[model samples]
Structure formats: C-alpha cells, structure tokens
Target: MLLEIEKKIASFIEQVDSSFVQELFAKIQHGKMLRSKLMLAICPKHPDIITLCAIIEMIQIASLLHDDVIDEAHIRRGSPSINAVFGNKNAIMLGDIFYAQAFLKLTSFDRNIAQNVAECVVRLSRGEIHDVVMGNSFQESKERYFSMIEDKTASLIASSAKSAAILANLDSEKYYTYGLNLGIAFQIIDDLLDVFGDEKKLGKPAMSDYAEGKTTLPYLLLYQSLSQADKQKLKSYFRISSMEAKEWISEKMQEKEIFEKTQDMARFFANKALESIEGENNLKLEEIIKNMIYREF
Candidate 1:
C-alpha cells in the first residue's frame, strides 16, 4: 500500500522539469505518511486513492519545509533537513515546487475536494504564523495552543479524511470529525514526546519546545500546578538549557502527575475519534488512533 503511494509520489516528482528539485526530494527523509495513510484507510480501493494520497503528501512536505525554516530546525525525521544541508533558499523553493505540483493536480479532482484541501493550506499557514507569534514569549493559554495546533497540524489530517470520504461517497462529516480529533490528539502526543521522548531516539533534544520558548501542554499544565515562586522559576528557565533546569523539571514531572493528566487529555481526544467512527468497524482506523495517542517516541 505504501509502495503505491511512493510510486505515485515519484510520478509527480518526475513531471517536474528541475533536476535540483528532484535531487532535493531525494535528500529529504519521508515520515510515516500518517496523512496519506489516513486517506488510504478511508478509501482504500478507490482508483484515485493513490493519487489523492500523493497530493496530500506533497502538501505535507511543503508545509514541513516551511516549518523547519521557521523553527530553524536542523533535523527532520532523524535526518539533516533540507535547510540544514542545502540552504534555506533551496528548501523554500523546493517546497514551492511541491505545493505548485500538488495544486496543479488538485485542479483535476472534484471541485469540492480541491477546495477543501486548498483551504487547509490556508489554515496551515495561518497556524504557522500563530505558532511563531506564540513562541515569542511564554504562553499558558490552553485555548490558544489548541487553536494553533488545529490550524497547523490537524487541519490537513482532517481534510485528508474528509476529502477521501467525499471521493468514496462515504459520510464525510464523520470522518472529518474523526480526523480532527486524531489530528489534535496527534499534536498533543507530539507535545508530550518533546518533553518525555529520548533525545537520542527522537533525534532532537528533550524539552526542545520549552527551551525554544514555546510553552507546551505539559509545561503549561505543570505551571498551573506550581506555586507563585515555582511558576516564576519555571518562567525564568525558559530557553535555558542546563543540567540543573533539566533536573528541576524531571523532579517536578515525577512529583506532579502532570504527565498522566496530559496523557488523559490525549486519550480524551483519541476516544472522541473512536466515538466519531463507532459503527464503521474499521479496525485499521481504530489502530491509527490508538497508535497515535499511545506511541513512545
């Protein structure tokens, strides 16, 4: 199944006339293709399923290119990122190529499908903007954080399932709901992993998000549970990476039950995803949600 999606991506890449773009594509590592997998799971046997997955994958990669540039991310999926190796210009331009290719293909699909996917791109960019602004200072607003993740991450994933449903003549709304929950849950789990995941295994530093000035859910929740002096101390530690700070955070995490609360929140969304698709009896979909919420690193 993934092979077909790869072939489809290759076909699209082959259509581009630039060797640089093609070569750049070769250099970047591919993720689990979670968005593509969600689409395929919804409309597995549809003739256009592979093409749809390919198009979304292009959009996903394009967004990531821009994200890495924004976050100054040097590594992606355990490999050196395009911006890290080739330069930001090449990374940004290659991303444009992918987005242009994806949009070009979208024109060939049903107008609703095309439009639905296009809007997600708008939200994705908006989400990116919100993330940048929020990162400028320590933020504790749960409302803002959830909204940002929905736009940046969940929007595309939701659109993937929604568009597949549209194409497959299935209940688009149900899948959209499921996708939204899954996307939000996915972001929450990512937030948890940033703090709890092994730095070596994740190919990034643990607490990287907090150190970078973006207060993730765990930190926010943990912050709420702290006293005034402790809160001030945590805020002061923002973007400060030292053994002492790490030790302080580790002791707090062990003492507070914050991790369990964060996990429960992720599980809440996971359950919502399952509830949204109650009668579907699609074990693959269930497994997707379960694996997403429960995975370690």
Candidate 2:
C-alpha cells in the first residue's frame, strides 16, 4: 500500500512538470510519509486513497521547503536542504509549484476536500507568521506556543484525517481530534529532540530552537523554574551558536527535569489521541500513534 502511494506521488509529480522539476522531487522522497499513512489508515476502502495520500505528501513537502527557507536551515533529513542546494528563491518557487499541483490534484476529489486543504494552508501560513514574530522576540507563554504549533503543525494533520473520514463516510470528528492530538504530541516530541537528541541522529544541529530564537516547551518550563541569575546566564547563552548553547541547555534541562516534564506533556497528548480513537478497533493505527510519539527520530 505504501509503495502504491509512493508510485502515485512520483507519477503525479511527473505529470505536473518537466524532468527538471521531477528531479527536485527526489529531495523530498525521504520523509516518513506519516500523513499519507494516516490518511490511508483512516480510509483504506476509498478508491481515490492513493491520490489523496499523494496530495497529503506533496502538501507536507511543500511546507517543509518553505519552512527550511524561513528557518535558514541548511540540512534536512540527513541531506542538504532544497534551499541550500537550489537557493532560497528557486526553492520557494519550487515549493509554490508543488502546492499548486497539490491543489490541482484535489480538484478531482470533492470540493469539500479541496476546501479543507486550502483552509489548512491558510492556518499553516498564519502559524508561520506567528512563529516568525515569536522567534524574533522569544515569547514565553506556553498557551501561545501551543497555539502556534497547533496552526503550524496540527492543522494539516487534522485536515488529512478529516479528509480521509469524509471520503470514507465515517466519523470525521473523531479522526480530526485524533490527528490534532497526535500532531501536537508529534511537535512536542520534536521540541524535546531539539534540546536533548543527538545531532547525528537528528540529522541536524541540536538546540535549533534556541538558535532560531524559537522558544519551545522545555525552555518555557525551565524558564519558569530558573532563578534570576540562571535566567540571565541562559539569556547570555542564547546569543551564541546552537552548538555552544546545546551543552548548557542540556545540563539545565536535566537539572530542572524539563525533558521529563516535556515528555509527560507529549504523552498526555498521545493518550488523548488514543482516547479519541477509542472503540474504533483499529489497533494498528493506535500502535502507529504510540510509535510516532516514542520514536527517537
């Protein structure tokens, strides 16, 4: 099933543009394709499931391309980012093309599906704007942080699940809730990885949030517990490179139990996701959600 989805994605890209653009698709083929998998799991019986999965993957890849540009990231998925190799302008154009293709593909499906996807993109753009603003000033409010991630990360996932439910004529609300909670948990775990994960395993620099001036949950939690002196010291570290800040944040997060607290919050959302899908009798889907939150990379 996964292979079929991949084939459809490749075929869709080939149909959309020239061979040069087709080559660009290779850079994005390395993702875990979790959104595609979730859509299939929710609506496996739908005849158009493969195309739907492909559309979801395209949307995710496009978003990642734009995000890497915004973050000024050079590496992604253990390789040079599209913006790194192709330049930011070309990368942004390619991302725009992919997004356009995704919407074009959605035209074959119901209008509601396209509407949902479009709405997700709007939320994603708003989230990115929020991230940019917060990244500059380093907002400390946990509620605001979650709200940003919900729009930036969870909205598209929720749309994927909802679209699948709509196709299958099933309970859209349950799956939407499941996807929302799971997406939130996924981002929280990503935040933890930014602070505590190995750079080699993460395939990018550690403490990237600090480097980007994006305040994550662990930082917010630790900030609340820090003394004035410690906070001042931490502020000093943020001005340095992520490599320099990594060790200091690592030690402090451990000392303050920030990692543990962050993991607890992730688990809380994971559990909420599971509860959202309770009585659905889809143990395989449940296991996928569990692994998503618990996996190292």
Q: Pick the candidate with the highest lDDT.
A: 1
lDDT of 1: 0.90
Kindly give the number of clashing pairs for every candidate.
0, 0
Candidate 1 global TM-score:
0.97
RMSD in order of candidates = 1.1, 1.5
Scored against the true structure, residue 47 in model 2 reaches a CA lDDT of 87
lDDT of 1 at 29: 76
Q: What is the lDDT of residue 225 in candidate 2?
A: 89
How well does each candidate superpose onto the true structure, as a TM-score? 0.97, 0.95
Q: On residues 1-297, what C-alpha lDDT tens digit does candidate 1 reach at each position?
A: 887888888789889977877789888777899998898889989899899999999999999998889888999988899999999999999899899999999999999999999999999999999999999888879999999999999999999999999999999999999999999999989999888888887898888888777888899899999999999998888888888898899789768988899999999999999999999988989999878877875
In model 1, where do residues sit more than 4 Å from their true spots?
none
